[model samples]
Target chain A: MNDHDVIDNLAESDDCLFCSDHIEEAALGILEAEDQERFEHHLSGCSICRAELARLDTAVQLLPFAVNQIEPDAALKLRLHERFLQERDAEPTRIPSPRKSESRIRGRKAPSRPMWTFGSVFAGFCVALAVIGLWNLLPSNESSTSMSGRNFQVYAMQSSDDQSGGHIGADPDSKDGTMMAWNLDPSEKHEIWCVDHEDNRWKVDDLVVADSGSAMQTVTFPKEISTYKQIYVMRNDGTQELSVAPNQAINGDEPAPSESTPAGD
Target chain B: MQSLAEGHPEAMDLLYDRYHRPVFSFALRMMGDRDQAEELLQEVYLRAWRRASRFTDARGSLISWLLSITHNMAIDEIRKQQRRPQKQQAEDQTELMISLRADGISMDTHAILTERRELVRKAMDQLPQPQREVLELAYFNGLTQREISELLDTPLGTIKTRMRLALRKMQESVELQSLEAT
Candidate 1:
């Protein structure tokens, strides 16, 4: 730091080097490592900087909330869900407890205390990515049991004039699923509905088709899949895309003949 | 959280559904590329899932915890990319502030979060340009205060002063906002 750097504001008194400005730097994660270590040591006795650190930490936490919310692709959700299930199957009963360390530079008052083994967590995460890459390289039959019955096709309704269609991935036993469509008109609002036997419909989600003639979003099904009779995608003017049963075959933009229709609930 | 720790998929499903937007949005903001952001998003949830048993009520709210994870990961990613010789980062503090100032605030955002976001923008808007720029340089751009000093051609003391002032003003604004709400 330059000589003039000492002129920056301190908490209440200028006697302490561990001042409010220094703590703010720590909160911002810009404090040099040696200074951060010194600041941590100083926090043991200085209540003024400690209080300042806690208060500044709250404001630091708020900044992330100010970011613009851009929804990720629907397929990413499917990938995450599959990864989660695979993680569960691999380690069925153990959730690893973090090894405690003051490794990160957040304030002492931070409750969760970001207790990650950054190197190990990051290395393990990379290994997981490699596994995902390998899974992609394998043919369908090689990984059929794990990924079977996972892809769902959302076709265009016959009355619709557009050629828009989508594919949603939903694990058979899991309630979480995501849907996405392509060739959609960017100007239109489209909603996905999960319909039951008596024609009761639950609006799973609605997405504004994106500018690239494609869109995707998470679907929050109201009930379990076996309880739903058909899923439909409808446009704003009450135009329907396609109504599909959970267990039936839906070809690309066309409704195929069902060889094994699910029993109506 | 209990079910999550006890190895329940439904619990993981619930946590992901409730908070993934904020997590995903923050990751995308930091990474900028769609694929990179999505990859970061998946890694974050996977980490949380593996460590669910460690999450306790004392660890703070789930939202804060999740955001903290995102922040740490983004920092690592940014620093990693910074070390690469082939590519230079394109977005700077000015562009970041403009994007944040844009009219893309979604109507569907949760009410409490939306309120906090608006209040933060107002607080940020009230700062002098120099202080605001310094704050973003450190907070968002991940530039060390020393680096910011070099980048802006200012004294290190002056950059420190700006960062302190910016954060102090923001804290007061947030405290006042909560008081007004109550």
Candidate 2:
């Protein structure tokens, strides 16, 4: 059954053992083996009980939030980071693989294109198809681009909807960028697009709204910062931008020393 | 995580920046010792670095996964302490609370997220003390209902009832908040 249909059927009792007697215990995961097994069997078929169980699970999961947030010593963070870097660095030298050598050999021996001839037309067509396939494998939109390098820049896009906002960042050295939006319409599908001064729009990514109507997604863009004048998000109806930003304005602004940070997080 | 799994050391730093406070908070709350909490923090992230590939998105958010590790380690440390004499009491609770408020100066990117945190806090505060205590013991202490019943010297049924009532009240409060927000 569809989710709504199951939810509608929730009121109908399926003789749920957990709902009747063991809900709190099951949720706490403290039920004995037999009772826990029985509850799981009942839950698989009882949407009402399952829904209740999920709510209880949420309550348990949220328990940690009740604790006071504590900042660990800066030295602690530094020590852990340095140790991990050392460990990671050590991992590379221990194992040598043949894949790199194979790839390098193949790259050097790659065949060149043949002269144009009547019989060569089919081969040319095959080569064109292969190129298109490889191009498709490469990052077509900004969302899939790998982000790295030191020249990172961030831009905040304010949504016309006061509740919604977005941020985009680009690393010119890495040739890719990322965008994130929060406080969207949870039920609607949103699109991220980059617009040039000439009004040419390039679709960058698509976002699936979270249940809370807030979403953080990473996207990679191909073109350099100068190519796109603005980045914006939209619903399927194409009414207005959910959030938008000016590329040059953000790029020229000096990034904070910790701009490459989880500050927002 | 994909980057971490590919052995990129930089992802470890990013992951630490995202989760260290939450993990440390949880460990401190459960262990009640600053030194032990710091130890747990280092161990958990080190394990994460080695096992990044094992993390699957289907399980939950990265923060949740990190907190799970923190909780597990805290429980282990608590059990270890039970075997030996207790260490001297750590920092004062009042001092810790003040530090917690200060640490929260770093707000979420979304205003809605900030509101949600406040809503949860308010809802939790509204719960009766007995009910709140029982829930906390079961959650942070990782105690089963029976264990909590014995620890608190209360009947098992009473403990279960308190948890049920606490959860119901919190759910109602969150639902009301959602309705008003809409």
Candidate 3:
């Protein structure tokens, strides 16, 4: 074959181990002597082929390098295995909760409270508050109260329908304490609340709305009222209100009630 | 493997034992952050559990597949973070230079070869930028030349030439270093 024909033929041959297709196996030194000789001949004349052969040789030499074994850390492996087991034991079809996933990403230590700790504490507080007739004592208008070293300000507004309305609670102790202002738009059935943290919870307290006219109701609790550690604001109409605390707010901007607010008598 | 797929706890532990270090090492090398590597290692295994069926021996060994996944994930992470300073990027270059300068003959060639830790890295630095990336994909990442060509949108010939040149350069570098030592 002519030089061009020879080169082209060599390039096209499946058996030409220098070709990129067979370079991997050739580099691994699996090529037969005839194939290796032809590849070496191509390497001697063609700079491109030469460079490739040299690289393959280097890579072969480096194969032993790649063999360096890395011992996995025992502690880290244990931790990963533990997490894997936890995930395996979890419901296979269940989607991971975004909050839990976020915590995992953030490496957040487990909260000191148990799963039911806050719920139970808040539940007990709600049952007692409801049973003691404290809800009745809250005025139909805006009110502010301080209890158990925590401050609370409540605001009540009249729905446009002049029917059941929503209230926004500003609890400074709440995570991301911000003034939460939620008022029932009489035109719509959906309840709305906005939270902010500034000048105590008075802004939110002033904005709380109830079905009872625009009467500004105020309920002050004594500083000595220490029994109530948790605060719950319930809609008098009996619809569940979205409760937010310093820890529960989206951004931890909710404000607590000022200590000066009197306790409910 | 069936147990792992079936959500058996012990299978998860065995899988972890099998893959953690290599995954962590890959992450650390790619991202250069111990904590981030640790976190990424955890995420990788978690993802493996969630997507175990994607793996099969028909394609390659489990370790090779896992390494490929880890490398890709780590590269994605590195791309997401701001690039480290050019100076830091050249740190390996500086290290090779320092070692070469400090010990001309007395240095143990076997030690250098065995370490292979920085030889490939320094050779990589010596390459033109595009060639370096191509080599990185083919060797470090185990991507096929075609995959690399597609990744860089370069011609197949170009990828082949780059790999060829990179490997030649690396060979020359190691040989030269050894010769100089002797």
Each model's lDDT = 0.61, 0.59, 0.45
Native A-B contact fraction in model 2: 0.41
Error in Å for residue A31 of model 1: 2.6
* Residues A1-265 of candidate 3: C-alpha lDDT, one tens digit per residue: 5323433455643434345544643453333334544554344335655455444564444432342233334577677767776765552232112233345535644343322332343354345434333543455333333222234433232333222232323343222122222222211122222223321121123224322111112223222212223223333222223333323333333344344433322
Give candidate 2 misplaced runs (Cα > 4 Å): A1-50, A86-265, B50-60, B76-92, B95-116
Candidate no. 3 TM-score: 0.33
Model 2 clash count equals 4
Model 2 over residues A107-173: C-alpha lDDT tens digits?
Answer: 4532222111212433443454344334435654532443323345556676553445555555432
Between candidates 2 and 3, the one scoring higher on TM-score is 2
> Which portions of model 1 show Cα errors greater than 4 Å?
A1-16, A19-21, A44-47, A92-265, B57-59, B83-109
Candidate 2 chain B — worst ten consecutive residues by lDDT sum?
B83-92
lDDT of 1 by residue, B49-84 (tens): 655655656646777778877777776777878831
Best by DockQ: 1
- Report how far off residue B60 is in candidate 3 (Å): 0.9
Across A116-158, the per-residue lDDT of candidate 1 in tens digits comes to: 2233333443454344445444676533543334233332222
- What TM-score does each model's chain B reach against the true chain B? 0.79, 0.76, 0.52
Off by over 4 Å in 3: A1-74, A89-91, A94-265, B84-164, B167-182
Candidate DockQ scores, in order: 0.27, 0.21, 0.12
